[model samples]
Target: MGNVFDNPSFFSKYMELRSDYNYNDYLEHPAMESLLPPLKGRSVLDLGCGYGAYAMSFMRKGSSSYLGIDSSSHMIEKARTENAGAGISYRVLDLKSLDTLSTVFDVAYSSLVFHYIEDFDALLRNIYAILSDDGVLLFSQMHPLLTASYGYSGYFEGDYFAFSSYQEEGRREGRWFKEKVVSYHRRLSSIMNSLSDSGFIVDRVLEPIPREEDIREFSQLERDLVRPTFLCIRAIKKKSK
Candidate 1:
């Protein structure tokens, strides 16, 4: 398989792990929600929208339309099977092919997705093009600090690749997945500059710290209080002159 996500068993296990409270639930999701703009009556493009976790939410919140795209067919299948809403549709499409998107969106969101693709600039440029002028693009990615360390030193050692195998924790016990996932790490400055060069005006950058309530439920998250593992961002497509 090209990446761990493309493997059937791995993707299956990942779907099963949706209820768990490790990274997705405890850390990333809240931060992403915090950065989101109003959804009512908007058209949304959800890039890397694995399993469509946020699909129905967009529809329920009154989005006029919602298109959720992921690279994995397995994920798209699960998304369609599990989630049903009038205005939401899920498709299998890789991030690099965003240039093929013809539909314009009022808001675009990608949660914990961008780190897997190395061509960050091109990805942003395509998203910028697909967005209506002044549309918002909100996303989250693996933090540069955590990626630079990988398990060791934290002194911003430049870009590199890291691999992971999923597991379960925090009152939940099981093998979440059985494959090695790979991601690329770029410096914070590089990430910012790439977005700016791609015509995204950075509105806010968030380094999410675990909430006290989350830590109460998942005590291990207290470690993350010191070193945030994820970065959530909100940017806008610049208006044409």
Candidate 2:
């Protein structure tokens, strides 16, 4: 509905599922955080910050300020309503237009949103422009392995894969809620190469697996523990003097 991500009804249901299960709390978020440097007293730009969930986490960890942007008004509204407080703001803005943001951030945090964007080069360039000289970018996406697991030709070459899903929209599904969505798959090389071309130095990469404790609680995650479902990256903007 509404291009897979902008629908109000779908987001409402999706947010419900998020809160019910802490779905992302256990997955890529923890692994991504482990790769990040201290964020205390830092300003953050949260791209595709759905419902400001990760933004709230950053703010709680002593981030000086958090600006969350997304393309869905419903998600923005829910974020503003649920996450209203000091050191936080939410806006309905598309990632393709990141130049509109004037503030330079010390950390630009995005999670599981890049695959939805078709123009990785432009998006990374825009992020590089608004980032401070030493700004760090931390983000996660659907792992290339997971995409290949679905079976596709040219798995090694840079390519795009499209699929239709009427049940869910994230790397993993919760029990209660589902919605119609579309997915775009691209090669890992293309993702990293684009970051390099956009003036970012790739520092670390992680194909996250479920921790032993996690699999102990949710035994269903044992399969994911063996095979990574998500990829995380840490990079820094190489701003020229």
Candidate 3:
């Protein structure tokens, strides 16, 4: 997944898409922000932090330190130049290597990156080990329904949504920016269960709905009313017994 973003053409297209107001800006971010705990004087770890886009924002919110990690060197380089600030640092590290980290954090946040990880259980366990007791873990991913389909068309047919293969979970290959992308699909129950098994206490689950103002601003967002495009979870690391 990280290699796909390293491709100049795909990375350029992705940057262009993010430059505009899209689902991430209007839907995902708002919900994630709402679930965030206090950040003042707390340490933050951002997983799959592309270009360190949210690094400064977290710093501005009074976080004592912020570490943004991504697997793409291109993204880390751009982040160093574009989003760098005091108390903010970027690392070129894959999510799979999280166990290599020894520093504990008060908050761990990820945005739309988990589905690309093949080993969800290991990922959560590593996160648990790196978080202080009762540390907050807030993350979002493509909703199960959206990722369940093998070849998903991001369009609806009249009133019907082409949804299938929900019970089957595994690798799903699709195209993004004319580049082949691979993502793993897991049922919603699996996600919750993995978190529990990793010693996290579920706090909040969100399937964001576009506010009326958002729909008025981007009419295409009305499609989300039919089916959620993203799912957000806020959980806390369970205290050691």
Better candidate number, 1 or 3, judged by lDDT? 3
Candidate 3 lands at a TM-score of: 0.96
TM-score, every prediction: 0.86, 0.82, 0.96
Q: Rate the local accuracy (lDDT) of all candidates.
A: 0.77, 0.74, 0.90
Candidate 1 TM-score, C-alpha based: 0.86
lDDT by residue for model 2 (1-241), tens = 2444566666665666577654366777788889876889999989998878777778788999999999888788878998877999998898988999888899998888886676778888899999989799999986765443332332222233333331332332212134534445567787888888899999999987777888787665565655666789999888772
Q: Write the per-residue lDDT of candidate 1 for residues 125-144, one digit (tens) a residue.
A: 88988999899999998776
Q: Give the TM-score of candidate 2.
A: 0.82
Name the candidate that leads on TM-score.
3
TM-score head-to-head 2 vs 3, winner: 3
- Taking the candidates one at a time, how many backbone clashes does each contain? 0, 0, 0
In angstroms, the error of model 2 at 159 is: 22
Pairs that collide, model 2? none
Query: What's the CA error at residue 132 for candidate 1, in Å?
Result: 0.2
Whole-model lDDT, candidate 3? 0.90
What does the lDDT come to for candidate 2? 0.74
What's model 1's overall lDDT? 0.77
The 10-residue segment with the lowest total lDDT in model 1: 167-176
